[model samples]
Each structure stands twice: as C-alpha cells, then as structure tokens.
Target: MALPVLVLAVRWVMMIMGSDPRAVGLSAEPIDYTINYLGLWAIRFLILSLAITPLRTWARWSWLAPLRRPLGLWAFACALLHLSVYFLLDQLGSFSLLWESVAKHPFILLGMAAFTLLLPLALTSTRGAIRRIGARRWQALHRLVYLAAIFTAIHFILRVKGFQPEPWIYAGVAAVLLLVRALPTAWVRRA
Candidate 1:
C-alpha cells in the first residue's frame, strides 16, 4: 500500500535535487518535511487501528475486525522508518548524539520511548506468541496500545509546539477512540 507513496517521495526528492528541469524548489532537499510526513502517516495509522474495535462494535462491521492487527503492524513499520531516519540520518547513529538528543529534545525523547514500547508489541503480535501466552494474557499485554497512544500523542504535541491544530486534532481523535472502549466498561461497573 505504501509502495506508491515511496515512489512518489523518491520522485519528489529527485525533483527537489534539481536533476529535473521542470521540478520546483529544485535546490534544497526538505528532509524534515519527509520525516514529518512519515511520522504523521504512522500516527494516522495508529489512530485507525485504535478505531477498529469501536467501529466493529458500534457499526457491526465484523469485516473491520481483522484489520486492527495489520494496521498496528504497519504503524510499527512506519515508526521504525521514522526513527531510523531521525537516528541514523539525522543523528548519524552516534550514541553520544542520540543521548544528547534525548537530553535536549523532549519530543524526540518521548518519541523514542513510544517506539521502544511498540517494539515488543510488534514482535509478539504473531499467532504463535499469542497462543503460547494464552489469548486472555495476550489481550492484557496488548492493552499497552493505550499507553503507546498516549506517548505518541505526547510526542506529536511536543513536536508541534504551541497548540498546533493538527496535533490537537489527532489527540482528540485518539482520546475519543480510547474512551469508546473505556466508557462502556466503567459505566457497566458503576451501574
């Protein structure tokens, strides 16, 4: 699905590098723009994955149920790429540089933490792991997705700074999706 996006990105980069006469801004390569685009897409996928359960239950679309895991895995893939670009290309794979980034940039630090948590979820998403651990336990472990979403929102908000509308929009959407699951159970228990 993302292959076309990658191809378009490559073409855009080539155009930006001024190899093509018809290209615009054909001089400066906007690395930051590319990274931000990937990050936002990953975040959007995460949001969509989070929405699956609610959509299934409320809309009674059982077909939507199967997409959640794959969507999450895709989110993890994009996140890995996003972090790789930042850490390898942006920070040059230097431990000292990454440490400095962690110390100096709260947003980057938050993003790193979020990505770290996601690694285990991505690894153990297999049917074998789920069966070995038992479904109930696996479900409990996967609840880490909520925390991951929270951390991701923090990363996004920190990245944008100063109440940017887009981060807030994503945060709002995530909050609603999470609340859809939480509110019903809380209500049932209270009642």
Candidate 2:
C-alpha cells in the first residue's frame, strides 16, 4: 500500500539528487541498496501472506483470510521491482552481462526460480480465475507459494556475503511459517 509507494518515492528522490553526499553512507551504489530493500520486502510480504491462514485458523481471525491475496500480490510486485532493478540498473540492459551474472551466480538462478513460481500464482489470483480453474485445482496450484518462499529465502541467504544475521533471520521465519502450514488440521484445531 502506502509502504511501497513511499519506498518508490524515496528512490525517485534519490535518483534526482544524483550523488548527494548524504546518501554516501547508505551504500556505495544506491540502486543495489534499493534492489535489496525491495527483495527483502517481497520476502516479508510473502511470509506475511502465508501466516494469514495459520493466524485465521488458530486465532479464529477470519478477516485475515481476505488480506492474504493483497499481501501476496504486493510481494509479487516488489519481487518484480527487484528483478527490474537488477536487469535494468545493475546490468544496464546488456544481455551478455545479464547472462554472465546469472551463469556465475547461483543465487540469481534461485531468485529467478522463485519469481517464476510466483508468476502463475499472481496470474490466477483473481476470483474469475479461481472460477475458471476450479477452486480445488487453483488451491493446489497456489500451494507452489511454499516452494517459492523456500527458494526466495535460499536466494537471500546465498546473495549476501560474509556472515550476516538478516538472511538467516528471514530463513528462520520462513521455516516457522512453513511448519505452521505443514501441521495437521486436527492438530491445529486442538491448539
């Protein structure tokens, strides 16, 4: 919602400022920072979307169910932005460089895999799509989100250099979220 808009606004402002001394402390390359920021937000929203079902079931918060679609869409949007930043700003429209980076970096492949999985889920998110595809089939297809989330967490972990806690924390959160989803319905109900 407003969060994505604000982030985009700030990015726009930074671009206009053009090598302002104040931004030096943020990162050597502002585009790189923005790409990472977008990717992180994508992961956060994806995790939040997965949490909706567990929260609704355990906490009896039925209203949270509807929020899942919007959250998931937002995650996809952020991921799209992340990819755009890397392809456009980082690679500068050079297909050779893009291919070189993808071939050299396994994390880029993981991120691409995650984004590929998300694409179909985002496409079939609408009510009309659900009706056309049938609810059961749609649900089965959307289960790919869990796999996408795993790939995304791995991508984040692999992308970072050295020993960073942030990626590990994201991985831990994703694991817990997946565990909640994996639990039996009866077990969840008993809790």
Candidate 3:
C-alpha cells in the first residue's frame, strides 16, 4: 500500500521533471512508469499465486496456500491500473485508436486479450463465488490464467519489435508453470 503510494508520488515528480524513466533506467514512461511496473508486479504475483497451489500440494507448504486470494486480488487491482494507463495515457482516451491499435498491433491485441481473460478470473475470486461454483468449476475457470500467460508473453515479445531476452524469460517461466500440471497428466497410467 505505502510502497505503491510512494512510487506513484515519485513517478509524478519524475514526470513533472520531464525525464524519461527508461532513459533514466527507471521505466519507459516517467509519468506512468510506476503504474507499468505495478502491472508487471501484478502479473508476476499472479503467477506466484498460481504456483502456491502446486507448491502446497507438491511441496507440502500449506502456509503458502493462504496467500493466493489476496495476491490474486492485488494482481487484479494492479492490472486495472495497467489498463487505465493504457487507455487514459497511452491511448489518450481514444477508444477508436485503441481498437485500431488492437487490430494493427499484434502486441496490443495479445495484451488486450490477456487482460480480458484476467477480468473474469478476478471477478470470480471471491469466497462466495468460489463456494457457489464449487472447487472443480472454479479451478477450470482459473485455468484461463495459463492462456493469459501465453498472450502476455506474446504481448511483451511483439512490443519489443524484435527478439529480446526479457520476453523470453517470461515465456520460460510460463512454460515451466504449465508443464508442472501437464507432465503429471501425461505420466498417468491407465490401469
């Protein structure tokens, strides 16, 4: 809470100073750079939240399980900021232009798709919703996160306009995460 608030304040100061956050080794946009990083934090923590299930089940860390929902909500909150920045600042309130960019820019499209998927998952993260849907159905709904990850990678990759190490790192992490669930089912013997 305090961290994000402080970061936002600093971002405003930097933007007012007319400094490029990325040029200063901060972020791409000095004004909204902090929000961008917050978005990244959201995505990273979302991934981390998903891993908690596997960690608890496989590694037997029951304590980590409790953190999932809160982290997921935090991720969602940050995602909202990310999208807000994209629309309000990046797109400059041009829905038409935003749609145009989605059609023309593969990265924008992929990222938009990823965020779209995340929207539903976040909405259903409540305890009442979980109880109403039950575990199996809820689990199925949340599985969209994996697809969201792929889209996110494509988003990052295309945004770079060429090969970049950072996107590859994200891709690799998402791959390992998906594989964890996949390898088990693949190894199951039909008796």
For candidate 1, the per-residue lDDT at 86 reads 84
Q: With candidate 3 superimposed using the best TM-score fit, by how many Å does residue 103's alpha carbon deviate from the native?
A: 1.4
Off by over 4 Å in 3: 1-6, 13-28, 185-191
lDDT of each: 0.81, 0.87, 0.74
Give every collision pair in model 2. Answer: none
Ranking, TM-score, top scorer first: 2, 1, 3
**Would you list the clashing residue pairs of candidate 1?**
none
Looking at model 1, residue 42 earns an lDDT score of 79
Tell me the spans in candidate 2 whose CA falls farther than 4 Å from its real position.
17-28
Candidate 3 has a TM-score of: 0.81
The regions of model 1 sitting more than 4 angstroms off are 3-5, 12-27, 185-191
Ten residues in sequence with the least summed lDDT for candidate 2: 19-28
lDDT of 3 by residue, 1-191 (tens): 33663566676677669876665556664535654576677667667766776776566688987798877777677777778877887788899989998899887888789889989999998889999999899999998988887887666666565567986787787777777776563243221
| Residue 156 lDDT, candidate 2, scale 0-100 | 93
Note the residue pairs that clash in candidate 3: 21-27, 22-27
How do the residues 100-125 of candidate 2 rate in per-residue lDDT, one tens digit apiece? 88788888889988999999999999
What is the per-residue lDDT of model 1 for residues 1-191, given as tens digits with 9 covering 90 to 100?
A: 47734754676777656565235332344557557766887788899999988776766677998899888988898898888778777899898999998889888888888888889899999999999999999899888888889889989988865757989899999999988787674453454
